[model samples]
Target chain A: MTPELPTPRVTVDADVLERNLQAMATRAAARGLALRPHAKTHKCLEIARRQVELGAAGLTVATIGEAEVFAGGGLDDLFLAYPIWPSPQRAARLRALAGRVALRVGVDSVASAEALGRAVPGLEVLVEVDSGHHRSGVQPRSAGEVAVAADRAGLRVRGVFTFPGHAYGPGRQRPAATEEAAALTEAADAVTAAGLDAGVRSGGSTPTATFTGVAAAPGAQGAPTSPGTPTSPGALTEMRPGVYVFGDAQQLELGTCDWTEVALTVASTVVSRSGPKVILDAGSKVLGADHQSWTTGFGRLLDHPDARITALSEHHATVLFPDGAPVPSLGEVLRVVPNHVCATVNLADELLVLSEGTQVDRWPVAARGANT
Target chain B: MTPELPTPRVTVDADVLERNLQAMATRAAARGLALRPHAKTHKCLEIARRQVELGAAGLTVATIGEAEVFAGGGLDDLFLAYPIWPSPQRAARLRALAGRVALRVGVDSVASAEALGRAVPGLEVLVEVDSGHHRSGVQPRSAGEVAVAADRAGLRVRGVFTFPGHAYGPGRQRPAATEEAAALTEAADAVTAAGLDAGVRSGGSTPTATFTGVAAAPGAQGAPTSPGTPTSPGALTEMRPGVYVFGDAQQLELGTCDWTEVALTVASTVVSRSGPKVILDAGSKVLGADHQSWTTGFGRLLDHPDARITALSEHHATVLFPDGAPVPSLGEVLRVVPNHVCATVNLADELLVLSEGTQVDRWPVAARGANT
Candidate 1:
């Protein structure tokens, strides 16, 4: 075979991707929750369209530029789930987005709320609450303050939102999801207490949003799903989980997904091998250098699940095969699942969509480099 | 006054960049070595042109895509410093690149050398030797085997090259450079013994290429330069260092350059703040998610060096300001120096060149996303 595909390129197993999309969509619909999957994960128009076709309410973006890309792709509803500090240029873009689509922005500070209000009057704003991530957002009790400020500045307060990013580590997803629900409930109460309608209470992450009955199982490393511990209905009305469509090593490590559920992988070629140590053409430039503290390695080989990518240079990934495992021959193609799928997807300009081991289409990462 | 320029963009100080270019060129010339700075650091055609103008013999690239882009930009001399396992598609591109420019590819195994030789006849190949980095490259003792194999496969064994990447950690540059020299010497000896002229002995890194006798200074964490430890003449004829033109936090920590010598920074706007914790609009998407063990933080604020970035999200950089230190106000613009400049540059689409606070030009990262 003349090499299945070019190495160091992002590839999505079409069958697995469709299955994941259906699973998440079915779960959300069953829960009676609006599924506005975060588009920052794939940044592809085709994926976003597929998401909407699967009953997604809208899309959540990270930057105004992402909002612009999705809007240009005819995505009319966008929620920038970031406390964006809009410069004059960005403020103009926000204004344009507000005029063109149903835009909702997150606000956690009085200054940001005022600036966003001034940038686009009557813009829908969600008061972000600290649901244990502690990265952004305000205290759940302080959501009212941000809501009042946004209201005073002529902005509309929709409700509250939080990211359970703390749900990422091993044995942490259950409590993190519980905390996410409780924080959203507290923030919703705070919004109502501030004399504002808390209509949209959003809380989720890939780990928390896909809870099944795996958490309480024997020998499980704390699954997202545990019997009778499902997130109480009405705890949050909407969910936003970015990485569910294409799981990663972090998700696998957290028991959020099985090996068969991984949709995205980098098709790489073995260029050189020294005994048991094999090097691939895919490296940090393609796989991205996103190593969480809990990740086993830079990435893992899909074909040989036991092999670990011990290190990465700009254009080379050093993989160490497990004891007695077969070493990949030079010129062999291997599928690699990166540690963080979101960052890995961000590295690619386009994704090669594969169905049954054949490339079907190329989807442009439309929102790539939309940092500003 | 209007904002100087857009926030969350990479900006290069024109003067500092020039100084950096001149400084490296002068050092390489003084040592009678040819400088082929790796273009993967900037991936900018303008910077490559400037390096060529400053007496650089050629540009080194990490990918064939980068080679194609730089070659298209009219830089004819290119060396892809990668052990590429070219698929049929890449082999065609490689043949085209070889026809257009003086091309050299790194090879560390017989299989790759044979494959490359079959793919493109009479291609120039450099046997890559492990100079202590241990990431790629064959052992020094084994380079002759690869060289002889290349010669047997109708490939031209021009010389040997090694990347002194182990020079990256604290108190490691001098020893790493020394090992790099010894490895090159050994590989060159082996090539000569194998009846081939190892005309080019290439070895370098940003930390190893710019030795300035600063490592031994009190409280210094090992610079590239130390007393009486320079490489002997003819040990290495060519040097390839990428990050000297835009020093990063790793360089600062390694004592490669001081703060004034740093050229690139991400201009960001203060979006939200509470007490000592401040958040900037720039985050991992703009600054890149590269964190070295020795790096102080994700990045250091240029205005407030004492303030350290505590955490990074997709679009927000959480900075922790020092006690009694001045905190940036909301909407205030701050320039941040990233930890790894190479990864940071790869995250951007263009670089905003600034001269004395005035925008001069925008250079496209033309060769970006050239992973294949």
Candidate 2:
């Protein structure tokens, strides 16, 4: 009998993914906060369902297309985590989605809040707060003005949320998490002072999740320990951790997770071996070109941890081993841990879930190309 | 009167694309070489047709799936420019494809050559040559051996091809191109000395296409000259320049083309503007996470060149502008030049082409997800 042909595939260690989900859930549970894992990482219904089963209070989505897919998959409470602008076309879709699920949309500006209120009469809006990332969100001082605008537009303004994205870099997570809590807490106080019910103060990144307590530690003066720590479990009602679902090179670099916890990898074959380089069928297209300067290469070869994929083309990856390692022979399959697991999954149509190294099932990357 | 909704888009400057095609064709024609532009970049039938019209002898594809698409589009002569080990399933497809078009497949090993020969009799094979990129291809000294194996298996050995992928990095292109020409010339000599018709001595990348000259120049003995130069017109038979069709951020970074030459961009909206960061609706999901460290951000904004997209999530690009520049208003549309144009195109289902900034036609990215 002939050997089977190697398929262009993404393999997920189901047990690892499950453990990661449980770990994050436990972290959030211990703090009495809601765990709303962002579905943008995996984009697989099975993973989303597993996250929900692991005690995710709600699902966070980055796009309406993603929200639609998760909602269609029976996830009733959805948060479109993006500050969606109300286009008439998207507004109709959001209205339809609102009818089916407990929908909460994100907003960072008075204009967006007004537009949302005009487009969907009874929409629940969350005032986005700028944590240390400084990406998208209102300043804590300006959160009240945006919340007041939302109130005037007849939209119910919920509490605040921030992404401690700055925690992603080296040695920045702890300080960033500290700043994140302070930013959300300040924003929540502003909203409450303005006579609005600041029901939720949400923030958490995978790298900062563990440092949430550091922000809550008290000083001897009977005052708050540090603004980074949450004094009350109800201070921030929710935590959103996406990449924890599939630990990637970024997560490893940030020391958020270990190699054993990396649940996703691309299965590729050594198609050619010449000189100091071994070429694999998986290239930038399959493994994804998401390398940072600190990353060893585009990805790490699981079979040889020290081997670095020095370069990648559309369909070929050039890997270099630390001198004297046995070169991979032609047709030998190898697993590559992508620099960014999220980008890698976006390239695949389906993901093969494995339990104890045995193929369990295949799940479509439902929102794989839903860019719009 | 209601204005027409803007379609999700990526435009091809037909004139620019044609000029690039003609330029490469003229270079190959002058070198007495055949021109086979790689089709993996655009992956559009229309662009492939234009390439053929501009005198490309055939087309180069990265996958059998891509080859099938072009073959079905009436392209009779093609080269699957990948070192694919032909399994029975792919072999059957190759045989079926052979019946439709003149197919040239790449092989880097004696084993793969034999497998191809056994899978599809009379298949035309090209011994892949490693010209210093170290991505794929066999060593120059091993070319004859692989050719002999292919011949022994009753396969027709066509010549050799190497991608000077190393030319992509900073200050490495000129040296890499010199090595590329030397490697290909050496491989061609080896093949001919082995009593085989090395009909094609093919190797060229967009960066090194100019450095592949036979004539000597001041301070540059045996240094490759631009393929665009008139002095070395008959040096190589075929040239594969794919990204030239749709100039990307990489092209700009390499100084290969100017920003004005960029033909494709993702149309996105300013969904949020809070604090110092402005969020765009298009993120890694649309623009793709193909950033090289040197790249300013995930992508360059067409209208706001000074604004750097500091961060990108799956559905959000967080852009930061310098202190004085006008922040993009909420709901404002923006065009983004992605770092890797090919990857971005692959992430979309369809592309809306514009003529003079007015939407004219829409083309499906036919081979969008053909990673296999």
Candidate 3:
């Protein structure tokens, strides 16, 4: 007799994903802004296509590898949304990709702009503005200098973009979004001051998307506006929000989305039961060890929300149930929502897509282990 | 002209790996224990073959996917060290695998033991004992009941095995090893009491391998015993230590190995730089976000040991260096040792083998993303 495959593999809720896409689309439409969500979160062509079909004008990617995966899969409009210093090898890939799609690469330094312009000949570039995430991008005031360098190198200057990543901590979303809008507006103005069109003034994280100006005023006369509200309608023309497609623990903590919107989960089986603890087959390798200090545990148990996965090894996740909840028995299956869905998806080859608890399709996480 | 593929994707220092392997082999040999090091850490057939040539009697695997890869590579003696509850699909695979090699499977419950016996007739089974890791494994006292079930179901009973996983964290190596011995001894006694010859009493983690009975007291003596000492002589017939083959950040933190012994490092390029911060191309996706609260950062930078990687996203690791350190320029490559090597390796498809700073071969991490 043969044994069945062990459970607790990565799964995507198609219905939930559709709902997230529709919600983002509705929000973008109300603001009269173009939605070009970042694909770095899902890295799946299918999801990218879904976003596009649901009113996303294009897709934002973080690497050439990701751009290639999406481009090969028929995504024609893409933005490599990082201030990437393209070496010759990467530049050539970028050049080829530019010819095949409406590719917009990011630049933060004069040398990078010049190098990309020389390598690609007719590449479109975006000046990356630092919207307080402080990881990358130039200061909002420096956007003009970078844009002028791109213009001198004969590259097409599009607009400016910033990631309000600082908005993702425990209770920093609201203020971070406001800061993000101000920074993006200043950066866009800098681009225009440099005699550039600044066609796309884009900036928004999942945590800040709701605050992107459109959500500032409710439809009814006395109704309260949603939390994140961008200052003005024309402040930014585009929004790039990833992670909304596959909500995880971080989104839950940041209040970016509610539990009903979380589309991705790891289906694991209870394999061992010790005193006050039940171990699942899904461990750090499967669920990923991305516990933020404030996160309740390694991950949250979907079947029993009160249970906390206290420990994780290579192939085992030990869940500790609260006093009142019943412990899961051996062979019982449970879904685990990871602290970070992006990292978890990167750790698997494929995901089982489910709709209404039935297996729908198996979509390959195209760029699953493409670390380099 | 076609550009060359990127160099230094994953650099493995052969000298360091060999040194670590030799040290563990020497320590295990002086104690009279057979080294059957776990291959789940590296998942490379080259490393597995090297361990066998270095006197490793057999190999330990965590999943059937891993076992299949090694078995296909001609590794004849193998042990699926995980307490897998044999489902029909797995049982068939196990039975087919057993026909090709000396296969031993692990079980922690009478139901699973009986299932394994019925599914794969004539298979050898080891009762898994919980040795304080509290993740998986049955109680040491329950070994007899499980063994009896295996016997009644016509399966051959091997001794017992336990993983002192608690030894992985900081400052717990020694105590965890002691508990491992105690648990294994108790399980072994239970097996004998159940009318089974518990032939192999295995225990030892990479961190606690030195503290096992075999390597314990004899080190202080000037005259070393010929092969095995009276107190430590094959106290446990076999030893299974995985990460010893590729020392990582966890090894350094646990004091099981030194930084100089770290063989594996993710080589990434600097992609973004800001005031007092630099972002590497590899982030949690490549280096893994497996840092415990005690861990300093997402990973440690090899070039600048004092630099701390303060934050990480999917594709970017933000490192902060003190005022006086030499800052890396954009496109300059750097090596990072992940806090948890196992999770990092599982995120890549292949390992770029390097010897003396020169590229040698690229070996596939065959079971790289085999989360299920």
* TM-score of each candidate structure, all chains considered together: 0.94, 0.91, 0.92
| Number of the top DockQ candidate | 1
Q: Rank the candidates by lDDT, best first.
A: 1, 3, 2
Residue-level lDDT of model 3, residues B1-372, one tens digit each, is 322455226667888898888888888787778889888888888888888888889999888878888899999999888877666667778889999999998888887777778888899988898889776788888998989998999889998998888887777876777677767877888899989968898877788876876443553354565442233433477889888877777777777878898999988887777666888888777777787766787878877878988888877888998998778887788898888788777877788777877767888987786555
Give all candidate RMSDs, comma-separated: 4.4, 3.6, 3.8
CAPRI verdict on model 3? medium
Candidate 3 to truth, TM: 0.92
Residues B1-372 of candidate 2 have per-residue lDDT tens digits of 334443234556555666667777787677666778888888888878878887888899998888989899999999998888776677888999999999998988888888888889999988898887666788888899999999999899888888888788777667776677667777777788889878887777676666654322422455556643323323345777778777787777788767777888888888887655688888776777777756677878777778887777767888888887788788888888888888888888777777777666778888887877
User: iRMS of candidate 1, one decimal?
Assistant: 1.8
Error of 2 at B210 (Å): 4.8
Best by TM-score: 1
Model 3, A1-372: lDDT tens digits are: 222445658989999999999999999998788999988788888998889888899999888888888999999999988877777788878888988999998888887888778888778888988888888899988999999999999899999988888887878776776677767777888889989969888888898887775433342234554543344556678999988998988788778878898899998877777667887888778777787776777878666767887888778887898876778776777899988888788777788888998878989889776554
Give a tens-digit lDDT track for model 1, residues A1-372: 325456788999999999999999999998788999999999999999999999999999988889999999999999999887766787788888999999999998988888888878898999999889887799988999889999999999999999998998888888887778778878888889999979998878898875522222332344464443433555778999999899988888889988999999998888889889998999888887877778888988877889999988778899999889889898888999988888888888889888998888889999888877
Please tell me which model should have the higher DockQ, number 1 or number 2. Answer: 1
- lDDT at B225 for candidate 1? 47
Weakest lDDT window of 10 consecutive positions for candidate 1 chain A: A212-221
